[model samples]
Target: MYEADQPGHGLDAIVAQRTPRGGAAQHGISKKYAMHHRSGPSLWLWHMRRGDFDAAWTVSDVVLEARRGTACPHLPRHEQWVWDGTPLAGRRVLVRCYHGLGDTLQFIRYAPLVKAVAREVIVWAQPKLIPLLRTVRGIDRLMPLHDGAPDAEYDVDVELMELPHVFRTTLRDLPREVPYIHAKPLAAFTSPIKRRYGRLHVGIAWRSGDWDARRSIPFALMARIAEIPGIVLHILQFGSGLEELPDGFGVLHDVSDISKMAAVVRALDLVVTVDSMPAHLAGALGTPVWTLLHMEPDWRWMAGREDSPWYPTMRLFRQERQGEWGPVVERVSVELIRLLSREAPQCASGRSGD
Candidate 1:
């Protein structure tokens, strides 16, 4: 088993204190599962209360099993568990996820899969994700998580990350295809951006600070790509980076709403982004995208592949070496230039081409 010295005694105490009504025997499984750190104590408590010890224990076993296999390195071993032996048939199931659009996008792929097995599948997502996740397949309803607990009740509830393993996913078994999220057009607003940059809009996102600094591309590299002619780069970054556009880069600053951003992405000719939400959004919209990836990227991107199974229109550009954004950026730049150059004739003739 992938046993590491239990690092947080405080957290262990928290789990012990929150032990469900099943008493210490069941709590023992909770404690062992908690050692995996795939979820929080509250989630464990929620599972125990629902009598999902079998599901919870399955999560624990899967983590231990994976750690002993070769796939352990690429897998997010810290983020999975088996379902307690509960038959999901006829049960109302709700899926939960913490914040982070990339994570939601990755796991939401399984929502439809889950719905296939369960009578109902309600996705409880962070508020920020609700707008986007509402469009995903297999979700009967979108429930916003509040106060770290599911706002709605269900017969069985599982964390969103746990769905893949519950379904026994391997690279070969993954649900790979694009446009899984079917978001409806809310309302159209005339973009001053269109007037300013003349058709052929492209969105750019370069950083996600919380996901490890190494996954982020340098601002300088993004600036170079923005300098490419004939393509308009709209900035879709959240928080401080929205105001941190590098010199000579044209960014649409007025986009504050995610729905509007989704519209803008849909209207774009292409999207070039780091491994972030914009990439997932673009994929969901069936928009053509070129995603920049770090060498040791999240498992959804998998390893050593130029195409993503989840998004048909999305292409990937990976770092041949770790922490090297320059090569990836340069390759993207060249590819963009070539793509545009090839399409220049089509543009001259007033025709659209890929």
Candidate 2:
């Protein structure tokens, strides 16, 4: 047992609060199965949430060793378990992305590292992401993931999420370098932002995917942010909640294309977003980002922390109370005002005698 994985590392409190006995039943999962699996991946998540990467990696080692020789499960490609703890050196490796877009964007940083050891690295990813990913290094081939079978052949396969375990990544070893995913500003997407000069151009995305409703902030609440002076707000949210956007809240944008969204994010001075794809995109591009989170966020944001080790440019604002976003919004507004105030003097000096 690693020192971080030992009893005093906050696991007891996390498991007790996060995984009550009946919690699985509330999600339509069997209590028996959930209990059985809780000690493995679930434990890993708890450790990760506490920023105990050493413990999480310890759990991962147990998992990989236990299931090393098992055959791939009979299930859909996205649900299928690949990567049976095989070493990647000198082999053609297929890295399948069987998770959300944000997950892929975060973990794909490992590709270049993987390529350092493997003979060839082929990324089977979401079709929409292939264009943006072309900007990344160490990929010999990029293929779209689909319902049909993949045409590329490989000696071994691994899930994108498993790369951290493969590398025995620690908090210190976790990738913090940015612009790993790069793109130029698309004129169509960035025209509104470029037109507004000498103002803080801030982009916002308040909605997350439907898997967790707690992650999404009410768009109407964003009016407080829009009221801040000397800052131009651009709405980078795409998908279901656009109708909730109050009139003239910000410049509405078509962020349906991931690559174009990257370009627009690159053009912005700062990005303020919920825990969504846009947040990952901004962080990946080396753009300064402020991520708002609910009381208990995903493991990536971790607990009791205001900064992310994964992306150095990212700052986190977390809720003190569950489902209460007013305080969080107020703090963000206050900080934005302070940011603008600091930059105002610099702007005035540059415009002097004009």
Candidate 3:
């Protein structure tokens, strides 16, 4: 029933079907509606991603209260029940993130907003985010929820991404503040990068995880981006994309940690990546990032837009046709040349000194 692709189906239909004869008034406050609905929160996210803010807010509150052994069984079982909108004056709140690195990076911007009310905000995050998210402000404490890691104590718990719905955020109200998470360029790589290649200093990350083949491009196609004149290309790939490069090509640095990777990113003139965490990281660091996207793109990038609201420094390169990367790469190459020609090259802001 909740299939997103189903014809004539929408959030309003679910709300209407679920609401009793008295409408939202009857079903809203009713324990029956609150307890029994299983797919409400997922539906909320579906609408939220589609930019239907009004429809998404309907289930925001109830879905969060979901827990094991209750009538609500929405989210995975957390040791402690989440207390939504609870004033955290002197409370130690646990901001546990369950999604992938990209999701965590995107939503962790709300940490400062959460800090305004909470006395102490402890971020319980995956190992990958620890190196980066550790730099986020308003976090009183940070802990890694790595494999075999033990649980800790807190007054309340929350899924980090859901903070947007809790705060009633709209497209206009999004926090576009750069450097929400901070990392410095490690001199170890920076010194070598500068001494060797001092052109435009472009970084390329052409792949995402293996789950989505559509989001990734052939490395051979990505190498074509290096053909741009007077611009030094650095491969910012992780495991799979790493390989021996052709001579006179970009250097693939040995970066095992996020902090080290971020530092390298900060040192670059620009980062060209797919829709992934590195793009989010570059945007977070206030770096000039040009992100290539798929035809049916992620909701965060929005539609028919070259710029993103979440990251002011980001310029999007989208696929004109589905299952194609040639057009996207061509446009990116043109933009790279244009950016390199500038006396004082810039993305959004001219903070190019870093």
Candidate 4:
């Protein structure tokens, strides 16, 4: 039932019986049994049933074995295989990822990197991410979750997160280019906001949903920032924090959609935010951004670099110690004052070093 023209390519019937698994599942048993079928290097498709404990455990074991030189690479390690780029070149490849927007964003950077070395890179991602990913640079094609075996079109398949370690990436060697999302057409500011906030608009996001305890900045800290003169702090965040916004904190605009968020971000002179998607988006747009990272930050932020290689216009402000926004906020406050006081320079003129 598979052909080159059909979605399944050729192994559609075989994949029909295989159930797909989600992240953190095990697949050692499947790999152990599938080893007997090798003929001119046949491809073994391992399907992980979502939330299946046994399956998750088996897959984890399979991955462990592959890393230890026992079994071949499977889901989760698939991206690593692609990055290694030797075994799967000139062959069809199937790639899968855990289901989440952030997970997708963190790993999708490898798609183009994979495409650089592999003949074909068919990605299996959560349905919600498909629209956002359409604008991403490197994917050859995409299949929604639970799509049957990748057909005869794939000579190999692997999971998404494994790409980095497989490529033996250290903090110094991360693929640091901006790769996840592209700049969307930004809407011009409406006459009212333009007149009310004036030309220099700054966007701020103080909290990230995933890292609430560690990532949230004290409201009082943001309040100190608002107190800075000649600058407007526009609240671009949505959800629960809106209720607690301090009085006289300038305008609070509800940005519920990605496109609208992009537009408002485009209109800003700068974005000062905690580590969140908005910071990433602003960096991607080459907008001037000051990103505040926690003491023990995400690996991507790395360590000891004020400037991000991925976003040229982005600057990093790390906490000197854990759970203290006081010093960081104070530093930002001082920097903002300096930026405000300086006379506007001609276009293309570089500002003095920070």
Indicate which candidate wins on TM-score. 2
lDDT of candidate model 2 versus the reference = 0.75
- lDDT (CA) per prediction: 0.62, 0.75, 0.68, 0.57
Off by over 4 Å in 3: 1-54, 62-90, 147-150, 195-198, 244-248, 343-354
Better of 3 and 4 by lDDT: 3
lDDT score, residue 243, model 2? 77
Q: TM-score of each candidate?
A: 0.70, 0.84, 0.78, 0.64
RMSD of every candidate to native, in Å, equals 9.8, 8.0, 6.6, 11.7
Model 2: colliding residue pairs: none
Candidate 3 local lDDT, 261-301, one digit each (tens): 88888888789999767898889898889999998765567
Query: What order do you get sorting by TM-score, best first?
Result: 2, 3, 1, 4
- Model 2 — which ten-residue stretch has the worst lDDT? 1-10
Q: Per-residue alpha-carbon lDDT of model 4 for 1-354, expressed as tens digits?
A: 110011211111112213223222353334453442232012222322121223333433443443343232353321223322235566666776643344455567777777887788888776645665676776888877654644336776666755653354434455666535654434344334445432345788887663245876867687788777667777876654666686767666557655567556666678899876678667755568899988976544656778766566889998998898999999988888778766223112321221
Question: Which regions in candidate 4 have their CA more than 4 angstroms from the true location?
Answer: 1-86, 126-128, 143-155, 168-180, 188-199, 210-212, 246-249, 343-354
Q: For model 2, what is the error of residue 160's alpha carbon versus the real structure, in angstroms, after optimal superposition?
A: 0.6
Displacement of the residue 64 alpha carbon in candidate 4, Å: 5.4
Report the lDDT tens digits of candidate 1 across residue range 1-354: 111111121212223322333433434444554454445454444443343445543553533333332221232323332234355667899776643555576568888788888999888676666777777778898977664455677887666665654675544566767667655433342245434333345678887654367667767788787677787777777754655675656656444566677766765667898877778778877778999988766545655679877778889999998888888888988998887867654433231211
Highest-scoring model, lDDT: 2
For model 4 the TM-score comes to: 0.64
Q: C-alpha displacement of 281 in model 2, angstroms? A: 0.4
Over 4 Å off in model 2, which ranges? 1-40, 71-79, 187-192, 345-354
| Model 1 spans > 4 angstroms off | 1-82, 170-173, 184-200, 246-248, 344-354
